[model samples]
Target: MYTFVLPESSRLQEVSAEVSLEELQSQPLQEMIDQMFAIARGERGDTEKRVMVGLAAPQVGIQKRIIFVDTGVDIDRKNLGHLEVFINPILLKKSSAVVLGREGCFSVDPCLCGIVPRSEIVVVQALDRNGKSHTREFSGMTARIFQHEIDHLEGIRFPDRVGPDGVLHWVKEDEYPEYRKNWQQWKVLCSWSDWCAMKSGKSSV
Candidate 1:
């Protein structure tokens, strides 16, 4: 029964604390996940408009190196969509190739969305929920999601990645497919003032 920590909010800006194996199997970890899911799923009326693919412990006011990824599961308690939990995650390797994708976050500045560049592929190593370690590779949108949550663990936000003029508004597909065709130009003219008024208390989808 807790809410997400907003931008410039209660959460401190620092790398999250590493979770020892003992603490991973205890109640504190379970409680932390509970709060994260509550916010991720909008169960506490604090959810974002966009579908949340993953969430980190720091966003839930817990500065621990823990994160959950949605892999299409049910009844997982804290993060229903959170099919997997990673503890003390470490990036083993990342593809040199990168791509620009429209990215958004639950902890970004109000009323703003941006097209941030992201790695095309990433291989990470971490401890699973059962405290077992595993190495996995992720690509496409899934890779993007993992990177975003990992950034939280390192005290990084989506806005911090925006280019000099990369801020954009959430353009709907049916309404503005043209925006996609004219990517760079659209971002330049995507005026922050226009979206500024649209800022809600939390980040956009």
Candidate 2:
């Protein structure tokens, strides 16, 4: 069974231990990757169930440096791509440009969301499911997903990255009508922080 150490319940605050090159080559590693996908794909929240794109080993109570990237899968009629596994991943490069984007974590309690400033693009190097090393670049939300999962390896969560004044608001299921209505439109350009700010009369934007 796959177990996710959600926010306060898990008390998971330590950085993950790196998986060695030899460990990545082990046959058992495939089973772990499979489980990660199962856990990520099956998780649902109280709100309008968020789409899970990737997850880290630590999220599943494993300390190893393993990440499951959901590249291919159908969620709400959108095909994300093929499922990809990364072992002992490394961030080879990150563009200096940054953008504030909406982000939410399954581990976070009450799971309202917040906005975070993330690199617009990032290049990563890691061992694939076959234990083969590859380098790739990602942009937009896909890049954000990689960065979010990688942050888990370093014991960082999205909320921890929000600016001091940035706000994260909870959206109860009943609020989904309004949330869903606006999300469909604002997500194209506005960050959650900005949305919250506007709602609270903090900013005119």
Q: Candidate 2, clashing residue pairs? A: 71-80, 71-81, 71-82, 72-81, 72-82
- What TM-score, to 2 decimals, does candidate 1 have? 0.73
For 34-91, candidate 1 gives per-residue lDDT tens digits of 6666666553232223356677888778889988776542221223344467889888
Q: What is the lDDT of residue 159 in candidate 2?
A: 68
Model 2: lDDT to the true structure = 0.69
TM-scores for all candidates: the values are 0.73, 0.78
Candidate 2, residue 198: how far the Cα is off, in Å: 25
Residue 37 accuracy (lDDT) in model 2: 76
- Compared with the true structure, all predictions reach lDDT values of 0.67, 0.69
* Model 1 ranges off by over 4 Å: 10-12, 43-49, 71-82, 170-205
Tens digit per residue, CA lDDT, model 2, 30-132: 7787778777767533224455677888877888888877654342314556557888888899999998776666665433566678998999899877777
